[model samples]
Target: MSAGPSADDVPAPDPRLVADLRADLAAVGGDGYRVDAVTALLGLVADAALHREQPLAARRVVTAAVGAGDPLAALVGAFVLGLEVPSDVLATALPRCGLDGAGRLGLLEAVPGGRARARLELRPYAAVDAAGGADWWVASDLGETATGGPLRTDHVLGVGGASTTLARAVVREPVDRALDLGTGCGVQALHLRRHARSVVATDVSARALRVAALTLALDGGAGGDRPGEDGAAPGRGTVDLRRGSLLAPVAGEAFDLVVSNPPFVITPRTDGVPAYEYRDGGMVGDALVQHLVEDVGGVLAPGGTAQMLGNWEHRDGEPWTDRVGAWLDASGLDGWVVQRDLLDPAAYAETWVRDGGQREGAAFDALVGAWLDDLAGRRVDAVGLGLVVLRRPVDPSRPRLRRLEEVPGTGSGALGAHVADVLAAEEQLAGLDDAALARRHLVVAPDVTEERHARPGAADPEVVLLRQGGGFGRAVRVGTAVAGVVGACDGDLPLGVLVGAVAQLLGRPAEEVAAEVLPAARGLVADGLLRLA
Candidate 1:
């Protein structure tokens, strides 16, 4: 295996090589050739690793290629890990590797087979540049294409779905201090820098942190470099990078915001060994996620927020909400847990195991069996996956817990706004009474559109339809009673009183009207179209 450059022996990227790489990447017509060459190189190394069972040796070859001062090095690393690294696209990035003075190549090199490929991608630099420079780069496996094959346990992938979801979900308000825990490839940290005065990014894997730092430096995402003539530094955010598990590195410090996309895969290690670095949290069950949820409150300042994407087990005879609620309750933080998706045990096991490359045959079945057994042993029946938003309250009264089922039709960006509303309302609730609520004006949600249909053949040809604009475009029949209640919700009446008045107008029992309208009314409130008085 080839070795990397030693401290004294490492040479700077050759200026000519850097220029050639940049030109090649920028060259218009050579995209196919670049992708083919890079992917072929990755395949060759993967085959070699599989034949020899020496993963590190295979990785060394990729490192050498990147260290050769060619942009193709990083391309090869991304490709080997199943990331969509278009040669033509990355060619434009070659100049950056050399321009930013980012030293050291930290590539995402994965063993050729297992679930690893699904989770991370490898990258490498020609050399390690000094820290705190004006230029840096940080790349993650967000928006990368999936290679339609079985996942390898240690496969590092390029960008994909989970990465972007977490990125957009993070709170973007400006803050004095912020932390990106489990900062895989530094994606969250890079984003956090925009709003935070000071940002700290930490990860359990040294390799991940190294790549993250390099990505930030090369991409000018982390704040360090001076602004160019345009007044934009290549790297503008002041980010402090650390290597540690979860919150271990920043034990005593509290922050205004904390974000994480953790390794929450609940898979068991065979032979007492972890399957991958990118996805496995290395706990027996959901312990890792539980620990993160349970401990985050201690590190959050009063009124600070923690947002994360996590997976929780659904046990037989146990409601998913109750299980997640317990975590929030234990944390002593006001929180909202929304289960956006759920998977049956069999489906969940197959999805993750197949992600590791075990498909639906005997090998796959055995893996599934192991997963089922693990779940059964612990009485887990399903897997609940979604986002958790927690607010550390200044008052420290019992924390509020709101559980919501997934409304796939709703927009995620809107959900962020809803969270803000929930927090605001929670704070104002102390001063609010039924009479106060009665005086508030509520706007009908834009998403809720009312359509009046006229049927010429009917005795009373008019019908009102309440339609939701997103998701599946679900439509509900709204009788006059419902319509009257909605029309009267101009924020001037308490919801309870509005229901009573509408019932009286329609000559119906208030109890029956209340039963039907209250739920829908609350939904409107939660969706931000209505406000509690």
Candidate 2:
């Protein structure tokens, strides 16, 4: 048996090769090989199962298609399922690219028995980012499901949950320049291209850079051009690919927007631990996150922001906010951190062990044990995984948006817009005192709704909840008076008028009502339940 494909073998996509490949991929006759087409061929159940890495059902569907000589199935079999396809079938599938071009692109490697195996995993990826919707082909090193083995150490990843999370959470505001700190498979760079005039994508591994180049080229969508020396990378975008570890590639440079799905996974610093370059940052504990938190501001232009996903350790003596907040305070950047998940050491160990392809075996047990021991050594009881958004304050001495909290929920929508809204709101509120704020006309956000819960027989005796339809979908419980104040916020009157009205109706002192509801109003405004008219 010959060796399987490794990081050493990857696509070196040239403009000509990429054009031909893109054309064949977009060919008509039910062989177009797009996300919708592949899903229809595999059926919903098989397609969904494939996403969960249970490919037996998808394989069966593709096998039936192969028997019927379906060209799309052949492409899916070789690329998606990692199954060997007859060379002639592959040739037919990629007619314009042809077998030689695919081989030259390091996309297909010939095997014995007159078959060709896929060198990398390529599939249709669809996303709705801040700019708009796009459907494109993405390529990267095959995963455990496709390879049927442990991942390569330097494996480049395709679009996964974390990458998508970072993408959707990026503020869609157009900017002159943006930076993708670790551009694995170039996923963020593609999204950045939509709004950013130019993108600087940096990665530590040469292999990842190669995969990113190919993905950027082939995923250019319709009417997109290949990358050129003038920085016009494929997809009608400009990217300057750089090589180095976090922040090192573009040290002195500042960008209007900087995004990263960095190597923030905390790993055991043990000799036998197989560190994947895509996830592990080779740091002790959560130091990498701390490092990024403390230093990422350096690259942000004034009034610029950086968004990233990361993990932080929860120890016995240290509060996570203080632990992470110290970094923010020291860095002198406006920062907000939302802790989404807090998992115990054992659970965290099991998660990453399975992530590296160890399911249930002695090796998996050993890896988990190692991670647990490492955590124990540092007295780490829990781990926090969440989103980090930071900005370089226009004024270094006075910053407005320093916040840390637990917002555990599946985010409702593009969080970038929500984040941007909050930032703008904070800055606006900072300029106004409580008395001045009362004079401003405020309206309830369109998506905000009030839910009152009470016993059937009890009237006005229980709870009132203000629910947000978007953002983090937070439900804030309020008193009857606050609810009345919020319900009246329709942009028609100043908040002071609404407060006095509620006070009179409640038969309460105007000062007491103002003291109680005004603070609540401030909180609601920051949470996006209420907005300025």
Candidate 3:
């Protein structure tokens, strides 16, 4: 992989040239301004590319930007394209792309004259020198300012918190075949290509696919490889780009891994306005997410896994766990669903409406009101936000059905690894019965902790509490003998033998201790905080 230029290393374009180009652009007023401005911008990007040793990349960015439309829109399109442009020049050139004298454009700032502008100023592109590339992009969104106006009902968002969160949370393992569903600008697919041998990236929008293709091509070209090498077998690093609805393009094929950051927004689609290709999946009230979960089973190969970020309706009488559990059981796959966040229907509707730049108080509130009516009509009390991971069940006769509360904190690469670990454990213990489980000594995972709480002015003055540090931090209560047995677990002895010895040391009846300790140990094993040896 070849490295692009560093931010500090990029040379600033000549001020005299910029001044002359601006004057020329201003002179070509009315009908000619668009053409003149585009031409000048292309030249500037090309000049920067040449200075940073990537003239081809610069030209590609210019081409893509010219086709994307408008001054602000073209500028945003150019920035993503310019990822391949040597950074040494981009740092100095980016500020110039802004209309403000300060060279800093707030992504949340509304476009002039009620035009919908792309919020590309978010830290989707950052200069890094890792993996042998000077301008390797590091995803960031810290300095992002919130939308100030009412969100356009149909808005095309650039990179945001939810997008990056899903990207990082996706499992990045070496696999023979992979698929990225709803691949907006191909960010998820771009990350998948790093590990998967072959990746098929699909989207419903031609424009999104075009941008994704360009991103792949530029990034690959700058790294000295051809982009668009899709459909090739494992280890080839090829990505097949497809344009279609979810799973429709790859109907017959089964992949080792599949991932999606689908258009999961639960919003009301009114009248004839076209839904934003990037955000709306055209299904009503969590239907898109439900469809993905239901259909993914048909495409995942045996031993394969699928990970998705989804939202589901939380009806008044239904427990979120029961709703998700039903989906998993019906899918015929061993699955784990972690509900990361919850929002009441009104709160959820308002949050997303504002997200699209619909911040005008009454207008935004009205839009949100419409969404709540839709949800209420559908019996949706709230929305459950979550990450779901599924593994194709090996046994047809018996399928795994497990649903737990959400894991705390943001799910990232480490969380992906944790899911992989959980799957491995499930497989290892698939057929083990009580006798076999007793023979294996399970260690209380390091993430499990015990706490003692003291009560004042009480007959029974103390309580012992068991807490799991990872996953959902589920709490349990246990006796001293069970705690000692857990503490001594170092993968050194069988459970039966360890419990037997502990009972003797504590002067507790062996049978009595066995009844209490065994169930707690089994529960720990099932929760994946303990590894059964």
Among the numbered candidates, top TM-score falls to 2
Candidate 3 Cα misplacement greater than 4 A, ranges = 1-156, 220-226, 230-236, 272-274, 404-413, 446-450, 455-479
On lDDT, the candidate that comes out on top is 2
Cα-based RMSD of the predictions, in order? Answer: 9.4, 1.8, 12.3
- Tell me each candidate's TM-score: 0.70, 0.97, 0.70
CA lDDT, candidate 2, residue 452: 82
lDDT of each: 0.59, 0.86, 0.61
Model 3 lDDT per residue over 1-533, tens place: 11221222212222333333333323332322342334455577664564443446545655465444333223323333322222222222334333332122222123344322323322223221112222112221111122223233323345556766766556666889999988766666666766777889998865456445434442322333343464211222677889899999999999999998889888787753235556788888888888888789899998788999899988889987887777877787888888888889878977776555454567766787788788988789888898888878767666474655665556323355556667777666666765676688777777778787767766542677778665445677777777777878788998878788999998988887788777777766766667776
Q: Compose the digit string of candidate 2's lDDT tens values, residues 111-131.
A: 899888898888888888766
Clashing pairs in 2: 227-233, 227-234
Ranking by lDDT: 2, 3, 1
Show where candidate 1 strays beyond 4 Å: 1-157, 221-224, 227-236, 272-274, 358-362, 408-414, 429-431, 451-479, 488-523
Candidate 2 error regions (>4 Å)? 1-8, 28-31, 221-226, 229-232
